[model samples]
Target chain A: MIAPLLQGFLDEFERLEAAMPGYEQAWLRQLRRDRLDAFVTSGLPGRREEAWKYTPLKGLEQRAFALPRGSALPPPLPPPLDAVRHRLVFVDGRFAPESSRLPADAEIEFLPLSEVFRNHDAAARFRIARLMGSGEDALDHLNAALATDGLLLRVPAGRSVREPVHLVYLGSKQSSGRAWHLRGLIELEGGARLRIVEHFYDGGEEAELSSVINEIQLAADAELELVRFQDMGARSILLSRTRLQVEARGRLRITAIDRGGELVRSEWLTTLRGREAHGDIAGVARLRGRQHADQVVEVRHLERDTSAEVRFRGVAEDQSRAVFTGTLHVAPGASGAETRLSSRNLLLSPQAEVDTRPVLEIHHDEVVAAHGATVGQLDPEALFYLRSRGFSETMARAILIGAFLEEISIRLPEPRFAEWVSSRMGLDHPLPWGGEKT
Target chain B: MLEIVDLHVSVGGTPILKGLDLRVPRGEVHAIMGPNGAGKSTLAYVLAGKEGYERTRGDIRWDGKDLLSLAPEQRAIAGIFLAFQYPVEIPGVNNAYFLRTAVNLKRKARGEPELDAVEFLRAARERLRLIGSDDGLLQRGLNEGFSGGEKKRNEILQMLMLEPELAILDETDSGLDIDALRLVASGVNALRSPERAFLVITHYQRLLEHIVPDRVHVLAEGRIVASGGPDLAQRLEREGYGWLAERRRASEALG
Candidate 1:
């Protein structure tokens, strides 16, 4: 029975391959073949694996998901960027080009993953091999086998892109029992700088599962800032996995803000491969109404003189649950490496729950690595102090909660993004500090 | 004007102030010098309505109203201020912010207009400089890292900012150096007016030299054992409270 299901997935994969008539990338063809083979052999991950303990894939067997139709293009692009830059909008795993906004920048290159595979063999092969790896996870295989449209980004050396690149994935309209497979690859050459924002939104009330994979490579002295915000509607299951590699003197900062979903899980894996590389990861999850948000991060310092910091804050209210697990590993001979991981949670309601686990694995003797986790409610004395100053009880509690999450929100480079997150957390009010409200 | 009639207080179910009686008319500064464990601090806390210090049998009237019936914040609006001996350190709460909120709370309660940030800053800066402190203290967390003398000076600064009608300096000069003591006393003196009354509680008579009092009382065993003029402080400083305790014991035995 499982073999036929696998075969059915392969038949759909073949249909998608035949539809792309002009694509001629040999390496991508080979990568797809290899991934399919791996999937046939490895099948799906079992519950015994430590990483898959909290999330299970048993629901996939209950129903078969249809391939997204590519007939309807996306709506009109948003703004001025619609002129120059290339755009690829995915709706339920199908490509929607009309809704994308592209800008005109010399060093900027954006294309569908199929085009990249057909034209740029070396880059396409590198990205595919890097993403697939040797792990035969069912989700990875399924994504490779069934992916309809993938977004590809490339930035040349010594060039900086001012306008932000946007990739938006919208689910099917009013469709239930469907699934989406999204694959994205971003490459930054030496001395290159890029800022990208990706948003995942859905308009349907159906039950759907989304498996997304993003791979980022930062060359020497390159700088990259990526912001990923997910606001999928209720009755949705999303699993997003991101892998990042930073070279010498390179910098990477990623911020993930999550809200509005029944069960959303995000995993971030980063490696500092060269000396003096820096990576900072920060995320905030606001949940309510029985929603569940899980964030798992793994940062490894593989060379000397590298540093990484991971900070996560979550606010759970109204029977919501949040889970955070951050692991920092320092390889041997990685001296002078400093890694700090902190996870703090605020529980606003009695029934709401938060689980935080911070782990540190240090093999180097001359490194500074520490991890801290805290989960609690607001302080009573602080609340009383604010209330005594004429602020209403509700406003006082909100201020205290906002102050607790301010440290993470302050790390966002853009004021608008910071304000968005603050407003989402209900912290845009004037706080009682320094005599005046802030 | 304030009156304390048969004020009795206890802490942890142990009586600290036993049938204490005192009265301060408007615009008068009365100094109460007491021996150790004379319930001096207890009296200050009871008047300020701090927790853990319960007034079992007492009637405190302020400005012709029952003061004991009000909460700490209400009393603050009614023009009562307590300059603590050991100022509490509230971390993460900026000093200026804390003071401004307190001042505004009292102002709003009295139907006065609230002061904006710029106006409050100007007024606070002038007051802080007048008390020999700088604006840097305003940026720091409220008394978190303050030295002993600095904490005492901050208490006086708060008293000055709040400007209550009935001010109680509870050993405000306890841990100050000579310069700080003089600065704090001068600040208190600057705030003294005919429309306000002051109750200065202290262990020694040294503070009296800077801010002279109209009357001095010696408290022993939770009650006023002797009352006299400024010379009484001098006499107690010389003779100590050993004789006063002896006389109190003998009088209790005779009764």
Candidate 2:
């Protein structure tokens, strides 16, 4: 009894299964078939499901999207970055080698997923098999069953990458009303350090649906900083999830800026698996018009002396709605684990909506956990103060909005990344403080 | 010159300023003293064009221009400034940036050339030095984590930078030490000019001792109950405002 909405995707997958990469490999074929069966059994999660209660898929299920094909010219990259040493470009979820600047260094191994499948790399196959074997839900299973291409990056032990590796996902409207799925994997060995910047943009004007899942694993003594900027077309829908695993003494920092897309659901699931592991997630979602953005985060501390912090800010204007849900869990016997989570949102209009929920579950007595969520409008006192200082009403509102999300910009590793986030959020005031002069 | 005649103000449908009248000519500093609930702050807020303080039946004229029709920012650009008793602490907004933006906005409104960051910084540093203060406050957030005295000084610093023609000090001496009081007074004294006027609102005569006023007016029952020279502030300090209501009743009975 598969739902008619997902029947289209199932049919499309069956039709293209034979041409998919690694189709001839028995194990890969079995993995895809099993995931497809899982997807069929559990269609799209409905409101009845606790995790999907705030998000409804009726708008996405109304229309069927065909697989994107044919190469279109990639749009010019954003300014403020004068040099990019290493970059991987994906057009419509398929790797575009022509637009990528692949690094030839010996300190790391970076390759497209299709290339890995073509070469029949044993280790790559094992990693992919393991990732697909542990599917969380319907969306994860669907991505596993259909994703054809993404990136695979691994940094060896004891090596620190000086420059950040840029990963660009461009949803081009060469052929309209299309859909694409991608899977990415990144691993840092013991004592390795790396920084990755991920950008999602729409190259043209058409409604496209995209889903991406990424797995990032940090070994002992490893550190990784990830910055993501998602600014796609106003009519596009995006579903993305990132799974993070950290070993002993490993640190992972994530800054996600989501200010685009008509309907977006972004999730991050992180697990501190070893002793003394640390992870922090900080992000901002600025939405206006009729856009809907949802950010869900879950962190699990499984070892002693682990710590996690999750801070998110949301600004919704017009008829837009923003939703944030954060959960922190400390496993039994995970003593001395500490966790803090907060979600603060600002509604700019009477019709705008914001919903936030922060949850904490500590099984160990020695564990420390705190969580808080607030949904409020801009401070009237702050606004009046700015107005009294000769700022126009609109200008005062903009300044207060900028200040509300200022902490996110300060946490950004690169100044250019901060500038990009500011521009997307329409915070381009003559800020006398940071960024270039207008 | 600034003038207010038969000014009646209400807040939430309750009258605060009932038939208040005041006039301050250019080149004169007038100190306004009052007890609590006498609408001393209300007058300040109304003059600065704050919202919610409705002008039910009143007319305020600033240099012969109607002032009630203007917005708060417009009134600021029109050369009126109010030093709030509680200066707002805006975290994440640098002090230098906020002041520079304010200075530039007023300048731009007057069709004057704008100052760049460097020029503004130099001017701000110079002012900071003249007020016997350090430049570190400029780099920090606008009054964030500042002490009570520091916050009062910040309000004075803004007044120095803005250089308003009619500067209204709304209890700026409420939460300051003796030294801070002198520092704030000096900052205001430096800007006193024949082309500018000061409307100093206070509850005590100590601030008046440093920034001496040409005239003193006692506001009671939302109206000027008494007006005299600088000696009036001293008499009130010694006698207190307990006699103000009785004195107002006596005057009304005589009328």
Candidate 3:
């Protein structure tokens, strides 16, 4: 009675079990089997699920995908960041030791997930068992079962890394119609600081799908800044979920930029576990053609004096659709919690659509929360003003769209990354000042 | 010359300008002094080709060319500029960049070479210096966070840079203090020449006192009810338009 797609996945898991990491560990084997069983029982999300209403998976359910086989050469990489010296590169969902530049620092543990499991690191296995499959849907369970390779990063207590660590996940040309499930774990000890830049790209232009699950834990007084950029092929689909827990006096800053892929769904779930924990999340999605992007964020204030802010800006044109749903919750007795959530979208064409929903469930009356969502066309007054100043309608619209997204792009971790984001959105027209000639 | 014949414009199905006619030959400044709701601002918007201002029946000719058929940018390229009463704030757009873009666009349309950044900035800085203003405004966002008087002054700053053939000032002195009023007037006077004409629209005659007009016209009921020399502006300032309304009512009764 099992679906054919589910049967195919099960068969693949059985065949690849010996080749997977931690194959000798009986506990990990049982753990993967239990999660796979859970996936089989639930299957792909259907139309009835409220969270999956906007993003349908019926098409994805009919297709069968297997793990990427063998190593393949990565496509041309993006230019290196000036401030980033430590690099980790993955090609075709497999770690590329040839392309990686490992860190020489002793205070940081930077290694592949396969190494962590193959070496039988008990500390990592414990955290992985505790944090995996924590999502509200079955996708996380699927990732937990099928994940083969990812990054495992840990910073010792009282240590700060001034230079950022870059992780590049590339779907090379040989990865067409292949799927990769990547799981990452990041642990920051008390008073430790670290910055990470994660980049995802499909160089082959025919990748089928990629699912990434990252679990982040920050201890007391820890600080972490994570920036992720996703630019996949037009035929590919990307599903990602990041679950984070911030303890007392911890600070977490995250920025997610989605610019490519036919379909993308990004979810960030954060729980403030201790007092004065703060989370700042900002995202931008620029989509055109028939592309679709959905971002869901939920921040829970479980302790007093915790604060969080989630802001997103989306620009959809040419029949593309962008969706943002934010939920801010204040647990009972978390009276001093404060939160701000906003999603503003611009529909550039008649066929373009955007849906934004901001929900605030404040259990405590003393908490201050402000949330707003707006979907509108460009300001007609501003448009007319620009036209009256001799700018063509196209140029005028581009300028206004650039201005709309400037607030978020300017804060990118790297200064040049802002330029890259603007160029990807086609907003990098030569200006009178910075540009030599127009 | 700029010529308008029997212009009729309506906004959102309500008529604002009905059967209006005017002409401004080159080498002259005309002041339009009218009461509120007399289509003074509407005339400026219509001339600049703003959308939603339906020109049901009108012929706007600029140097014998049909103007209404052209788009707003086309009109702007043809040397028409309107200083807004409430200048719009364009956040994230640098003032100098915007001014330079507009200037270069006009120049390119006219088959003239565009100025580079250095040349453009030098010219702009000179203009600011001549107007007794600083260069700080050029670095900020266009009209963003500007005070009331500063917004009006910024409009004049734009006019100075654009150097349009037909400049329309729509209540450009409403919220300006005397000092700002004088600075804006000087900025305008600096651009005055035989090859350009100005249409200054205002509710009060204070701006006219600084940039004395060659001709003054009183607009009422969407038509030019009276036109005379500079003395007419002084007369309206003293009489407060009471006699003009009485005269209009008398004419209506006769009809």
Candidate 4:
């Protein structure tokens, strides 16, 4: 029997397909059908799944979510970022054309993804397929069948975008009991450089759940710096999948910040397909209350001379739990590749839990790979050391935990941006002493 | 201004400090020189109120108040300081920020205003320069990846910044080079005042030559066996703990 949690999705899929625009192409329809069938067969991951054993989705088992509609012109909320220019806003799964803006020296292309699918003929379908990954999972199928609107960016060859692009997803009041599927397609041509900041925020109780799949492709010698900040409310659930492929000598760096959620799981996979490519991924999560967060990452080095560094830092307080797992694998041909993974977690409460695992699988003996994982509470010696210097117990613990998370925060490409993200989520408190909330 | 009377401390299941009694008056720097496992570190940990140390029988007073009743941080604000025998490496905590929080907390407890980051930085930078420390050292994690001498020096730097009335130096000169020992001892000497006191716990007499204590106490088997002037530390240096061990054996036999 199909799990009741996923049964409603089949009906929702039928409704979305009936209302969605531009299915004149039989190929796209077939692709969506296959994905839906795959989800029906495999179903949502259960407690028995080794990767999801610690975090269960019991709350989502009995809920039903429908797609929320968006407006062509929507009122603007206060911009979360101060220094960054050119932001593409999507509220309630629909791109807000009026709320979006582009730079004056805009040499790149930025268009609504729905518009691309609508205008592209059968011949142009190759681009769509390239952006759509294997499309193999429940959310992947859901995203394939029901994605409403997204931002499509194309940076030309040999040109670098100086200003960072902000992909802001806002959940509106009408989004209650609604789940949105968002897909972003980003392509950086050969030798091109671009930085994209993907931001996800639930306005309040109205927006409850969302699934996002972002596709990023870097060409030869191209460089892409992407940062993701998820600051959803405690009542919200968000699942995000970010996948990227780097060509020869291309560099891709992603820094993700998760500031608590009712349930949050982020899957990040990167493939280094060319020689001398570098992949650097770092994420930090600060969970409190009954919130839960999971970060799963996989890095594949398929070519020689590739290097990747992955690190995750997490803090769980109250009755919350945080899980982080990183896997690095080097193919036989990628003999000269080097990879390193580090996952560090701090559990602030006895009820809180953290699971960290770092795995390295190397098919080539010539490659250098190392991984380390640690899960522990605040060091008592460190705590006493701070207290001996007159820091109160709470202040001492905050300093140590915040500092532990700073390993990821300090390395953000934008320091002010990092601070903004932290302060908004109550994760970054620079004060030596703070209220009981910290 | 610090007094420890009939101090008894136990670690795990065994007693480490048994009936240790000592009085360090104001305007004096007392030296505690003992051999390995002589409870020198235990005494410091017990006085600082470190957890896991059970004090079954002890009374410690600082500045006419019951210091043992206070928490570790409370005792700190009450003008009691312990330069740890092995300073802990606090990963990710900023050194400068840590020192400032310490100074400001003590100040707040004493009914003084807390310094802002700018003011704290100015004050800390001045003290850091006075102690010949790299200004950038604070930018890194507190005592993380610090060299042996640097860690000891960092302890002294905190001591200098906090200016505790009664400071306990627990083997602060153990891993130091001759130069580091001189710098740390000088830092301590510079903080000496008629209204303040110090309890320097060390295993070597080389530190005494730098700070020149007012009195030296020899602790053997968890209790003070002898108390004398600086000449005692000089003798402990010339001749190791062999003489003290023999004296303790003879005293036990006579008893």
Candidate 5:
């Protein structure tokens, strides 16, 4: 039964292949077939896996999702549109280029994944195979089996792109158990530098599931900074994963912000492959009203003289729940490797729950590796100080929350993205004092 | 400007201040000198309306208005400032921002125009220079990682910005060098006016030399045992509180 369903999913891949009729390559088609086969064998992860224990796949069993059929896109993008330098809109497993704005500079290469498969077959195959779900995980396999529309960004060698690339993923309107598996491949050549921002938004109020996978590879002396924003509606379920590989002297910085969703889980796995490589992973999750947000990150220091830092902050209000699990690994012979993982959670309501865990796995004896997790309410002293300064109790709480999250916000490479995240967290308005929302 | 009549306070069910009376009319700087555990700090905290200090029996009045009934912040807005002995260190809150909030709170209460950043900076710069402190201190969190002298100077800087009608200095001289102490004292002396009053609490006569208090009161076992002119501080410095405690014991024995 699973074989046929898996084959049916692969059949959809053939359709995507046929859609790009003008440019078809045999090697690219074979590689996609091999990846689909890998997905068929792996299937969905079960309770046995430690990473998938807390998050079960019970809801996924109840429905079968089909690929979206039509070319209907979402309404025109919202205002403050100038904030995004470039945008690629994907509606129901298909790219909507008409709704996007690309930069004029030819140094930064941006195209639909389908186009990349047709035009740049070798580059696409090498990136997808090396960065995609080569691990022994079921969800990753499922994503590979049913992957459709997404983005492909490449920064040429010795070139530096000034603006950030934005990828906007929009879910379909139908209530079908349809899953939109989208993947983004960001390839930075040697001595290349770029910044990319990916946003996943759902316009419809229908119950649906969408999983997005992003793979980034930084060549020698290459640098890349990426930010992913997930702000779907309450009826949507999103499972997003990103894997990054940095080579010698390469630098990769990633920030993930989760604002709204019924159930959202994102994982980041970064590996430092060569000497002097650096990876910094930071994320913030704000949840309210029965929402669930989970972020898992792992940083591996496989070579000597490598350093990494992972920081995660979450605010849970109403009946919302948030979970953060961070791990830092330093392999043997990876001396002078310094890695730190810190996670802080703020519970805004009595019913709100936050679970944070930080793990450190070190096989090297001469390395500095530390992990810390703190879960609690706001500091009473700080709150009282703010209130005593003429701010109401509500304003006091809001200010302290902003202060707590400011540590991460200040580290954002882009100011506009930081402001956008702050606004989503309700830090834009003056705090409502005396139980009145202003 | 402020009156503490027969004030008694307790902490953790233990009596600390017993029927201590103090009156500071406008235009005078009164200093309270005593040894450790003499309830000097307690009096300052109680006057500032800090919680955790139970007032067993007392009536504190400011400008003929009952003060014990108000909250600490309310008391603060009413022009009662207490320079803490051991200032609390708050990390991540900028010093300039904290002072701005405090000043704005007082200004709004007084129905005065609040200063914006530019206006506040111009005024604060003068005050900071007057205290012999640098502008970098204003960019850091409140009292965080500050030296003892810097903390006391920051307190005086706050007083200068707020310009409270009545000020209480609780051991402001405890952790200062001679120069820092003189600077802090000069900062306080600059704010002395006929409309303002001060209650200076200290364990020694070192700071008194700078401000030159009009009267000095000695507090022992939670009550005032003696009151005299500035010479009393000189006498206490020479004779020490041991002789006074013996005389008080002898007087109690005769009674």
Candidate 6:
């Protein structure tokens, strides 16, 4: 009974495969085959996997989702990044030329993969062939198999782009119930620096199942800052994954502000492949009305003198659920590895739930690794103190939650992004630390 | 003015304040001196509207208003402030931002315009300097990682920001050194006004020496056992509560 239906699901997917732009290219054909064959064996990951135990995928099942027809007109992207002149827009996971405004600069290679390959850049032409088939993440494999169009960005050695590059992925109303996969590639060479912002939107009422995979490669002494804002609509399901390889003296700072959907799973997988590399990751989540959000972070320190720090704040209200799982694995010989993980959560109602797991598997004695997590209500005393200062109960709660989330704000590479996050979380109280002058 | 008549309070089904009676006119600093288990902290908690402290029978009138009928924040807006004995440390909340929010909320409740960040920063800097503190404490978390004295000074900073009409200092001088004691005392003295009242609860006469009270009352076994001038605190300091407890027992027996 199940075999025929599985075959049908794959046959229906062939319709989407036919509509892809670069479906006939020999290199892309080989890449898709490599990823799809692996995905076919295991199927979609389920709750049995240790890393996927808390994420339920019912919202993504039982329905046929096809590729969407791009709309002639779509709503403008949400700001403070809307005014960003260097934005590249993608509708239904395909580059939309009408909606994007691209600027050219000598230091940046911000364009599509087809354009980069046409320009005969050897480094750009071999990216997918080199990095696509190596990851074990099931979602990454699925995205690589389905994706046909996405942005490719590169920063040459010793050059820094003055303006931040922005990428906006708009899910059109016509894209309802369509499962799309978007893939992005970013590479930074030695002593290069850049900042990128990625935004995702679910533009319709019907459920949209989507997956995104970002592959990043950083050379020695490289630096990159990335901020991601995701709201997959009220009924959408998203599997977003980011994988990075950092060399010696490379730094990667990332912040994720997530207001999740019916089902959303966001993962960060990083490997410190060289000495003196560092990764700092922070995120804040607000979930309500039976929504489910899961954040997973894994850092592998394979070399000496590597460090990583992760801090997450979550608030779940109205029968919602939130999960934060982090793992810092220091190999036996990776001495001088310093890693820290902290997660704080507030459950507004007794029905709301938060599960936090900060695991440390350190095999070396010369490393400093610690994990601290707390799941509780607002401090009764602090709540009383704030209320005793003339703030109403609702306002008091908002202020404390804002203050709790302020930890992520101070560490933002673009501090102005804090305002957008505070308002997005429905916490408009006066921030504990006043907004900066800028 | 503040008045409490036959106040009876309980906590977790256990009686804490039993039939306590007290009154203070406006512009008077009245100190409640008592030993351990005398319900000194209970009095402050009840007046501040802390949960779990049930008022079984009581009538508390603050400035011609029924205080027990109001919520904690309403009581705050109506000019009642309790400087906590142990100020809580709330990480990630900046001290200056916390105070400014409190002040602006109170002002908004009273039909006043709000102050922007610049205006609030300037005003808080003045108050910080007046309290003999610096901006470093303001930049840090609200009482987070602060020393004992620094915590007490932060309480005073809030008081200075809100400028409440009635202030209850709950053992504000308990763990302070001599310098902190003088600083806190001076900060309290600076807020003395014709329309204000003070209920300073202390276990020692040392604080009274710095800010002399107009009257001193002795509390024991959940009631005001005796009342007199500042000399009473000094006498209680010199000679403990044994004599007062014996006299109260004899009076109860005779009655």
Model 2 agreement with the true structure over B210-242: per-residue lDDT tens digits? 999999999987888899999999999999987
A357-412, model 4: which lDDT tens digit per residue? Answer: 88788999899999998887888998898888787787777777777777677655
Evaluated on chain B only, candidate 5 has a TM-score of: 0.98
Interface RMSD of each: 4.7, 3.2, 3.4, 5.8, 7.4, 2.7
- Show model 3 residue runs off by greater than 4 Å: A80-84, A103-107, A127-136, A173-175, A204-207, A429-438, B108-118, B242-255
lDDT digits (tens) for residues B27-122 of candidate 6: 999999998999999999899998889999988999779999999999999989999998888886767777877888889989999888788888
> Which segments of candidate 4 are over 4 A away from where they belong?
A1-4, A10-19, A23-38, A48-59, A70-80, A121-125, A129-134, A173-175, A205-207, A348-350, A359-361, A364-366, A424-438, B116-122, B125-139, B235-255
What's candidate 6's DockQ score?
A: 0.48
List each candidate's DockQ score.
0.13, 0.48, 0.44, 0.41, 0.13, 0.48
The global C-alpha lDDT for each of the candidates, from Candidate 1 onward, is: 0.76, 0.86, 0.85, 0.81, 0.79, 0.82
**Candidate 4 collision pairs:** none
Best by lDDT: 2
Q: Write candidate 5's Cα lDDT for A76-106 as tens digits.
A: 5544345676777887667887778786765
Ranking by lDDT: 2, 3, 6, 4, 5, 1
Candidate 1 per-residue lDDT, tens place, A142-222, comes to 777556457777898978987667677777645566666778778899989998777777775678778788788899999
Cand 3, B chain, TM: 0.97
Native contacts retained, all candidates in order: 0.06, 0.48, 0.57, 0.68, 0.11, 0.62
TM-score ranking, best first: 2, 3, 6, 4, 5, 1
Clash-forming residue pairs, model 1: A25-A118, A84-A103, A84-A104, A85-A102, A85-A103
For model 4, the chain A TM-score is: 0.91
Give the per-residue lDDT digits (tens) of candidate 5, residues B1-255. Answer: 788889899999999999999888989999999989999989988887766889889888998999988877777788888888877776655678778877987898889999888888888889888889977778876788998988898889888998988899999999799989888988999999999999999999999999999889999889999999999999999999988899999999999
lDDT of 3 by residue, B9-111 (tens): 9999889888988899988899998999999999999998888999889788999999998889998998999999988998877788888989999999989
The true-versus-predicted C-alpha distance at residue B136 of model 3, in Å, is 3.0
